[model samples]
Target: GMAEEEARMMRIDPEKLTQIILMGYTTKEARRGLRSAQGNIDQAVEFIIENRRLREECHREEEAREEEERIQRRYGLTENGQKINITYLQQLQSMGYPRRACVEALKQSNNRLEEASEMLLTNLDTLITASRVAKRDNEDDDDQETELMEDATHIPQLIALGAEFEEARALLEIYGNRLERAVEELLQKAQDSYETMHEHNDPSLFERARTAVEKRMAKKIRLAEQSAADQQRRT
Candidate 1:
């Protein structure tokens, strides 16, 4: 009785059975096929071939849809290639390309993105060279100005004040315009008779002054060292 009931249930639904048969198999053929296989799916594969075909067709359509969407999102067709907007221009400016140079490079390269990037890099090189040249010119101008100022000033004051050649040159270069500060500093040095400003005209006097300064510095160094030693011992 169970086998008979199973056999009756195994009878295919007429609507589904019609669709399958319309695709090519007859109803008797579909039922015979299912019954011969005893409802085993692996054995009834050819009977469900239409379903498998429909599934594969739907999968292909979905893949095509996804590919088109991806293309639109990645490279939306705009009027003038991919939009090189203001943000990109600002980014180029921050990388050190002058505003005029950036615009010129973009125009020269026919607004091609990669070519424009290369042009900006080339302009940066030119700017660096120009900066170096300007720095050198400025330094030369400063040296010339210092020499002119030194020639115009009294050399005897520098020699008498025991100012080193370099210090005198610097003062002449910068302080020639600030006469009050220069005079005040000179007067202070003269009053203090600081060892740095004391000239040693004779070899003996030079040696004597050198020895005195050295001894004074040595005395200070010894006092500092003794204080450090006392602190260390206490610790």
Candidate 2:
């Protein structure tokens, strides 16, 4: 083992090692780099830099892998030890589903794209709404990812008017980014969503007439309030 020990000792230049240390390389690293470069100081310095770069690159890649694993766990992908296929995710995104809904649907449908598509198409409204709630309770990355996936400018504008992020983003898309029109659409969706459930098709004709009239009046009042609010905002 004398040869092995001698090889380990090699010909590390103390001055080069010290210089490398002064440049913030650890003494152990400096010694390794200097020996590897055969005591050429410039080569040693380059070796140290390259070594550190490689290490940093490796560390970054490891962190990315861990983050991906964490996402899979958070969205239930880890439950079955299955990774969401990137191709399917991209396909779903191309189909206009936000990444959050696509991810959840993929998990629920066992990674079957067809079932996920159907689930998303049928329950999109509920999923989009749930996605908002989930995002609000999630981390900064969720906010950043949602911002990237949705219309960045209009969601916040509509949020200031009390719309949820998903709802606001979806409406803005439908109205071709017309902010006021989007707001009106949002107000319309919310205004009678609750009252419509109670509308009776077989009520006494008189009772149906009176309730319908009341709903019309109530809708007009809300619309007026929205218009005044919009006008005030503009001024």
Give the alpha carbon lDDT tens digit for every residue of 1-235 in model 1: 9999986768765655565466676666666556655654345546456555886899998996675454334322233454323444455544434333444344445456567667655454453344345446545332222223212233324534666545554555567635456556767766566544554444457788899999999999999999999999999
TM-score of 1: 0.19
The candidate that achieves the highest lDDT relative to the unseen native structure = 2
Off by over 4 Å in 1: 1-85, 123-235
Quantify all predictions' global Cα lDDT against the true fold: 0.53, 0.73
* True-structure lDDT of candidate 2: 0.73
Cand. 2 TM to true fold: 0.47
How large an RMSD does model 2 have? 18.8
TM-score of each: 0.19, 0.47
